[model samples]
Target: MTVIPSLNVPLLGVAVTPLNRAELLAHIRDAVQEGRQMLVAGHNLHSVYLWYSLPEFRDFYDRAGAVVVDGMPLLALLRIGQRARLRTEHRIGSTDWLDGLADLEGIQRVTLLGGTPAASTAVLRHLRSLGGDVAWQGIPGDPWRAEDVDEVAEEIRAHDPQVLLIGMGMPLQERIADQLAARLDVPVIATVGGALDQLGGTQSLAPRRLGTMGLEWAWRLATDPRRLAGRYLLEPMKLAALLMWRA
Candidate 1:
């Protein structure tokens, strides 16, 4: 196994790896070709904070196939801290990566779960445009309940999807994917956040320029200040405090 460099956050045992976007895609492609089941997860600062403080969250990441570097700020800090030997030019988001996969013919039948109706619809439209054969479903509300599980599982099994894409946002999506993997025989599952919104036109993505600069979070905050401002600003501070306390 390849060992990424260690991150020294207080109470956090998370590590940064040398892997970049190309490496990530290559691995996923290989897994698909080999017919192996895989799970891909993306983590931002909020997720990092939660993982450090929550045993269950940490366990989820520990079991994931690839826990990616989703936030530019997090990647920058990792590079500045020299915690990982990652390539400075390597940066990619989950949405773009998934879009790329939509073009590949060997990806197998795909199922999309989670996200609001509009978001899921948009993602389905985009994938169809790319000529992929995808099995799509959108949960109208929260999918954490046991009833939701049975219903979603039945749909997934009925479709017999080889790959599943879930977009319920952090921890929740990850937990759902984990449970689905245990309960079902799907080979690959990916947990993506807000990707459906961007695809569906419900949420606008940060401009390419801002994204390149790692200020996409600011754009998101600007677009949905009421929804994001408090969480983004306060979560990091809380995570930092938790880390310090652990130390």
Candidate 2:
């Protein structure tokens, strides 16, 4: 199995792997070819909140094979840690690379879980257009609950995909990813929050320039203020207190 280089900082109390887009894709390809298991995940500020507040969520990151920096603010914090060695390029949002999975040379089958039925349909349509040689399947994970794992695992076992992308959103997706990873032989199970929704055009992605400037949160707030305002505004303060308590 590939032992991905990981670092855990006291500031965040979470583990992260510093892999840029190309390196991340290469790692996924290698894991599949080598028949190795990897639970690919990422952390943003909201996930950081969940990490401190939820034990099961924290456990998933502690054991994840790869946790890349998904939030630019988190990347900035990691860069200061000297030991993390995170660079500007290491900040990878799923929107930046989810489409690239279609181009991976060794990957032949991919499964997508989560999003509404319409969103999953759109993702399948998009990916199929990119990789004619690959097979894509989507299992709508709407209304997902902890109780649904067994049925979902059975569905996954039938598909036998080389990669599985779960996007039911934080904590829940991470929880399901952890359980499914343990029960299935799939090589890579990536917990990719709402990347599928954005990719499927059901959700808007911030412009690339804005994301590069570390103002993607601002764009998200502009788009869905009611839902994201508290997350963007108040959570950071809560996170600060959590970090201080931990420190």
Candidate 3:
């Protein structure tokens, strides 16, 4: 059995567990069967930066039931520490969870709460293609707001999905998942960030080779400089600074 440890990034208020694909799926099944509520978040390097720089992000992560390191850069850092010993072949992520969830038995319905209409449709379609033939549904949404909470929650309650995936992007997804998990009777809710965006053919992710080398940030920055330049270029400096201060 793989023991789960909370890899604390002190001052940032994030406690991540080095949970690979297998462990995450098993944990979710157990949590759901026991009726245990979970506010799970997948954290990457950019997530770490946001968690530290944005107080709200930090707060949500701190309150989460489980946080998993979802990017290779963070996984590389963890490999140097005693907090975890994850398999090197893959950086387990929310997408892996989708596969894991799909492989399991008894997930009747799944409600997706974020991403554009097209992305939601594509992702749902893909998830349904998985082995268990999971029914992937969604609550139609656009540029989201706190006021939409009631509507979203009502939709979730109506669907009563066994699983909920929120891909509303970083802080917003985390915030919305936290709010929804508080009131909804759903079995499990995971804040998957932009994992659903991969479904949108337009939102191409970095290639596997680059990702394995922990250079996915570079690929993203190169492709979308206007949007991700600062994120990929400057935010990692904060991580280095944090490490230096800790040392």
Candidate 4:
């Protein structure tokens, strides 16, 4: 698999990988050529909540290849919670990986799952603009549960991409990636929440200034108040309780 060793930084009882962004990307590129399938995961607050509070997510991540800090707070939390000396130069999330995949060479094929047909098609068009040689496929459907995974896996196998991008959002995407690890012939599977939507022009990201200040969550909460209130507020409070209980 990936020869690059992952720093084992466990937060709220869930294992997280803190790796240099450049190195990990290179390793993923190399692993694809070597035919060693790698399952990469990136964690946001919601992902952390699920990993710590749900046995199902905890188990799946334990079986993953590498997990990066997807949210800004997650990076700080990982360093503060465990292996204090750990220093990951970049907060390498799935969105960053998606950008890299489109920009980087040698990766021949990719499959995108999630986003509406319009959004997914837009994402494919963007990827094509970045690189003409990268073939793309969009698995246009949401498999909300484990039982639905079999048919989804079938669709993925039919295209058989070197990199599989799952964008169905948090827990669902996490579960889907786990189910496909053994079922599909893809070399890499990644979970990117709404990234395809952002790329497809369906959604917009916060300003870089806001992101650098770690106010990205606030921006999201403001823009999509209805959808994010529970995630940005309730889940974090629940997570605090779990952390205190653990302590």
Per model, state how many residue pairs clash.
Answer: 1, 0, 0, 0
List, residue by residue over 84-173, the lDDT tens digit for candidate 2: 656677899887777888879888888999988899999888778875567888999987767889988999899899999999888788
- Total backbone clashes of candidate 2, pairs 3 or more residues apart or in separate chains: 0
Q: Candidate 1 on 1-247: residue-level lDDT in tens?
A: 2222334422344653335666766777677777777677766787788787778878877666777777776677766776566554455666667776665546656788866666677767777787665445455333346568877888889878767888777778777887788889876788887777677677788875776688888998989999898768998898878878877
User: What ranking emerges by TM-score with the best candidate at the front?
Assistant: 2, 4, 3, 1
Residue-level lDDT for 164 in candidate 2: 95
Candidate 4 displacement at residue 61 in angstroms: 1.2
The C-alpha stretches of model 4 lying farther than 4 A from their native spots are: 1-4, 8-11, 78-89, 142-148
lDDT ranking of the models: 2, 4, 3, 1
Put down candidate 3 lDDT per residue, 1-247, tens digits, no spaces. Answer: 1224577543444567777677777777777767776767777888887876788888877776677877876676666654555665437666656656776766667888877777777777777776585666766555787898987898788878888988877777877877887788887788876677765453777776776677877887887899987777787787769756856
lDDT of 4 by residue, 35-61 (tens): 887778776778878888788878767
What global local distance difference test value does model 3 have? 0.72
Off by over 4 Å in 2: 83-86
Find the candidate with the highest lDDT and give its number. 2
Q: Which model is ahead, 1 or 2, in terms of lDDT? A: 2
Global lDDT scores for all candidate models: 0.70, 0.85, 0.72, 0.75
Instruction: In model 3, state the lDDT of residue 62.
Output: 74
As a TM-score, model 4 comes out at 0.88
RMSD in Å for model 1: 3.0
